[model samples]
Target: MNEPCSRLAGVAVHLPETTMTTAELEDAVEARSPGVRIPRGVLERASGVRRRHIAAPHELPSDLAVAASREVLDDAGVRPAELDLIIYAGVLGDTVEPATAHVVAAGLGAACPVFDVRNACNGFANAIDIADALIARGGHRRVLITCGELLSAGIPWRIRSTEEFFAAGPHYTFSDAGAALLMEAGPAAGDGPAGGVLATRFSAESAAWALAALPVTGLSSDPDGAPLGIGRFDYDSLRFAAAFNDLDLEVLHKPLVEAGLRWDDFAAVCVHQAALPYLRAFCDRAGIPHDRTVVTIAEHGNVATASLPLQLAEAVRGGRVRRGDLVALVGLGSGIGAGIVIARW
Candidate 1:
């Protein structure tokens, strides 16, 4: 049987102008946890991230998505009217009432079908999978997949414990960014990209779901008491880090093997930017070249669902990726979910 096929038509990305450095994060963490000690250099050396971009106080996910979608359409020479579908894949939403996709689509002047995919950090890969399916089914000629993450909004400023963790090196590294990819059916009458969608795989260890959960607990206040919002990261996140690290390898192996390829077959691998330590451990276990693995966590921290696409966009913009290269998009995050998509671009 022939493999499925899909092709990337175009790509574009946007990063906020504001940046937060490792030292700044450390100071913030220190202020929250006076006794906690973390070496700033450890963050940089381990994460390969020097700084991360953040949105302004007034900016929302839809705002970033609009900017990014425009750039992508312009680069692809595609007009808003030409888009058949728009999928916003990210954890952050413009509002709890209305889907952020509607707002972003309107902002982009797109008068087409629009929706969202919430798969945490793996959202982009999941979006790609959905777009590919639509093209395969001949239901859509062009599908626009966009992701926007505003991770800073979730930070608890009031709680010293939560505040310190946000101030920690990882938090400073966390950034706000958006990315868009234009995907269309392959040149031939096939479901896969011309080069082929070799294989796609996903895995999850449900028992480990609580590893990186955000519980809706009461606020943790800074020196000046103020009501910090709900949803704070559980410090015990470190405990499940090991489980995710192990799952990363398990997830990649299945698709790779089914595709009759090895880790060395791909020119580059785009994994979710969870954190510095977990990423390193995954790389070491997989035996994939660390240099080939794109790192964004140190700078962008963990952009939840937007991380993978943002990393892919960076690699493309930096000229690190080119035509006919075997690229892997791997996603791992809450839900303890992990997915892999092999793409030829």
Candidate 2:
């Protein structure tokens, strides 16, 4: 028997009402460390993020996911009880035990097989990949993957000096947001590649995992452990950027090769956006058309695992992507991993 095609059935996103501008963050930096000589506009110039959504202190990461999940479930007209599986894929969670997926499931009153998938920023894309496989092989008819990222919670608001500023700068480039995507089995009522997910490819460079992290060690400490405590944003952004200096285009080429498609074939490509410059650089390195890609880094900031779908939602709403339109989701996250999911919207 042939594998049943799994397609993106619905998508929804939730952004916190609060916002923090780059200039405001810079002001806070200078206010906290008066002696530091961090220049204004430098942060925005480098990060390409002007502002980002911020969750309220009372909001938990699970809340973000639940909000979006409810919207998606309603949009898809699929009841919680009808879902075959549920996956909470994100970097932030309410706690360590009980699995964040369970929180999301309970929030929606969903009673089905559920789990969590955490791969730093690539969590959502990877979750979609896993759900696609499960639907194709496990006979699960409907799978929901949700991501809730409180990336701002990791930001070290108090900087002591310029050196400290640059090292922790990566923390400021993100915003808090929730995203939910529904994948359903079987064909659709469109002309999109005979229905949903067409191809997916994943690659990892584990050795380069040290590029960035916000570790919370229980009993032990890392060799280069973050002395500042949890959410330290312990990474040298400069070295990390240089690591991708020699980026090979194979991350993208392999997908096209396997799926028998071309770069131009996609209506809009949604690449992970930790920052605007990196997104642009990756596109340039991959030779993908500049206009063909969506730009959310500047406005949304990096929404972490929710980044791809947020951009995708914007594209579809704006008419840049239509039903049956072919779209590609590219992910590049801290674990130093990459993945591409080709689906017909």
Candidate 3:
């Protein structure tokens, strides 16, 4: 007998109502940090992000996750009680302990085993791989994977100097959003309308992890009355770009090789929502046509861990992807890690 595999049953997303255009963000930067100059169009040009949603101060990651989770369950025609497992797959969570999945599960009235799977930006793809394994090995039928990003929360509003602001530049491209996916055990490969995951591979470059990092600093009260604590992100953009291209060339085709397929076999490819230039470069290096790729970074910015699923959902809604078409899901996260999943839609 063939191994049981999971097929994507449904996908749903939620975005905050507040939008900050690139121009507006620059303006805000000027107002918040006087004397620091972010030239017109520089932010958008650097990140390829036109605008991004900002979560309300009171909105938590769990709230966004629940919103998307409810919609996905409805889309899949499944009840909360029907879920055998719930995995919160996001880079940020509601708190430091007890697992963010617990909060999301409770919000959705989900009575199931709950946990979290975090892999920076590759979270959604990683969760899918885990769910597929459980369904195949443990006989779990239905699983829910949800990710909510409060990316704006990490922005340090009060920068002490131009260098500090410059270090945070890459973060301007991040947006607040949530996405969820419902997967269930399905017939073997080529047996259903919702196709099974044909192959998935995850790789990491630990030595290069420090190339991108989000570190929290300033725990003690400051005499200047600034916030007691703040989150700061740093990255070597040039190094990351070069490393990303090299890694793609090395492993982007592993899944295809493992599955004995070719680029022509996929109808669409959903790469992580990073800068447009990086996406274009990756596609070019992989020999994938521009028309075969889906990009959300320009419009939504990078939604962090929700990026992959959000991209996939957007492509489906836009008709860029269709049932019976094979698509590739590629994820590149700050962990300096990459994950690829090739599936038939």
Best by TM-score: 2
Per-candidate Cα lDDT values, in order, are 0.74, 0.85, 0.83
Candidate 1 vs candidate 3: which has greater TM-score?
A: 3
Considering summed lDDT, which 10 consecutive residues are worst modelled in model 1?
A: 188-197
* Residue-by-residue lDDT tens digits, candidate 1, 22-83: 66765665677656555557667655666767798999888888888899899889999998
Root-mean-square deviation of candidate 3: 3.3
Steric overlap count per candidate: 16, 2, 0
Query: What TM-score, computed on C-alpha atoms, does each candidate reach?
Result: 0.84, 0.93, 0.92
Best by lDDT: 2
Order of quality (TM-score): 2, 3, 1
What ordering of candidates by lDDT runs from best to worst?
A: 2, 3, 1
Model 1, residue 136: displacement in angstroms?
A: 0.5
What tens-digit string does per-residue lDDT give for candidate 2 at 29-87? 77888688777887899899999999999999999999999999999899999999999
Model 3 off-target regions past 4 Å?
Answer: 160-164, 191-194, 216-231
